[model samples]
Target: MPVTTRTVEYPADGLTMVGHLALPAGADRRPAVLIGPEGPGLNDFQRRRADALAELGYVALAFDINGGRWFSDPEEMLAYVMPLLADPDRMREIGHAALDVLRAEPRTDQDRIAAIGYGTGGAIALELGRDGVDLRAIGTINAVTTGRPGEAAHIRCPVWAAVGSEDPIMPPAQREAFTAEMQEAGVDWRLVVYGGAQHAFHHPTVDHTVLPGVAYHARHAERAWHDVVGLLDECLPVVSPA
Candidate 1:
């Protein structure tokens, strides 16, 4: 069987949002994986990841965070993403819009859905889990910003977060806060910190990054992706071809 891809555009928050959908070559409904990219929005890296997941028989959607726009400048990206991070409601709106698109697809098995996000997109995935979106697994990398204690109580799925030991954006204290919040919420959660890696370690392309705290580490990136796939397999295993 082969993998296939398509473009899905939808109206969101008065802006035309775009996403890349990857479908496995099968007739059976597959477990869906929603990918939220870094603050730079969806790009080739995220789309490639989606396609890889689809090759493993998961229907994957790489959704946009900034109306299909990406920023090469760190200040500009933060200026756009910081406000959304501060507003949990807005993040949930963006996430739910993407979720709706994934669930509407014929190949997606709505009952078994997982989300993986990087940087700002990771926060959006976490926000969706906090809003009780009924996801099976939530995997985040370099974006372990904790939600309000009360809001975290709504998360019913398992969460797996990975970060670099030296990443300033999500330092040790922030990671502790996120773990504590997840513990208090009684959510099944796991966190991994890789040594010698920086923020956005999973990013393969360095040209898109221009931040002081962000760098790409190939080894850690591969390990983090494997860990995320393991989480999804444990919580939302896809059916094999018949």
Candidate 2:
């Protein structure tokens, strides 16, 4: 389907976050998705993801984290994102703000919305679910951060998380802890660890190196995207009118 793209700006975390909105070609309301950017903030990579979702007949919003800025230096990105990760409130705030933008669109069917994020953005999506948002599904890539004590219980939708086996940032212990929390909370969740892949494996090649143990795996990236689409197909499928 032909898709329309636009720039959206919203306020969150005391900064004006600029996001990219993609609308599928249709007159009827459609299921919407919230796309959170990686720790480096929103960039062309995320914008293209939104466009892909739009082409798939869904409204997608690629939200920003650093007030319309993109960070190339790993240290600089970590300097800004580390503190945000520690503060769940701030993460939820950013997620909710983006959700609001998605919901406000006339093309969006508010009842059928999903949140998917990459890296830091994935953590934000999980935070939204932990905060009890009414998302149909939550998907994360390379982010398996455990939520607050007993907070996973608030997630009312299916959770899907994917990480690379060699991702040092989300090692086996961390993945175990995250799954344990979900199991204890009784939330329906699944975790996929791609063998031989690294952190940010889903991301395409960039001009500069992001971080050690962080590289794109083309095969695993396709597989992970298939898994995410399956999750959405099951949890938030868009029905065509007869």
Report per-prediction Cα RMSD to one decimal.
1.1, 0.9
Model 1 per-residue lDDT tens digits across residues 8-117: 99877567899999999978899999999998778899999999999888999999988888788888988988998998998888999999999999989979999989
Clashing pairs in 1: none
> Model 2, which residues run further than 4 Å from truth?
none
Go through the candidates in order and give each one's C-alpha lDDT: 0.90, 0.94
Candidate 2 residue lDDT tens string, 81-185 = 999999999999999999999999999998999999999999999999999999999999999999889999999999999999999999999999999999999
| Best-fitting candidate, scored by TM-score | 2
Q: TM-scores across all candidates?
A: 0.97, 0.98
Instruction: Report the error of model 2 at residue 88, Å.
Output: 0.2
Q: Which ten residues in a row have the lowest lDDT in candidate 1?
A: 204-213
lDDT of 1 at 36: 94
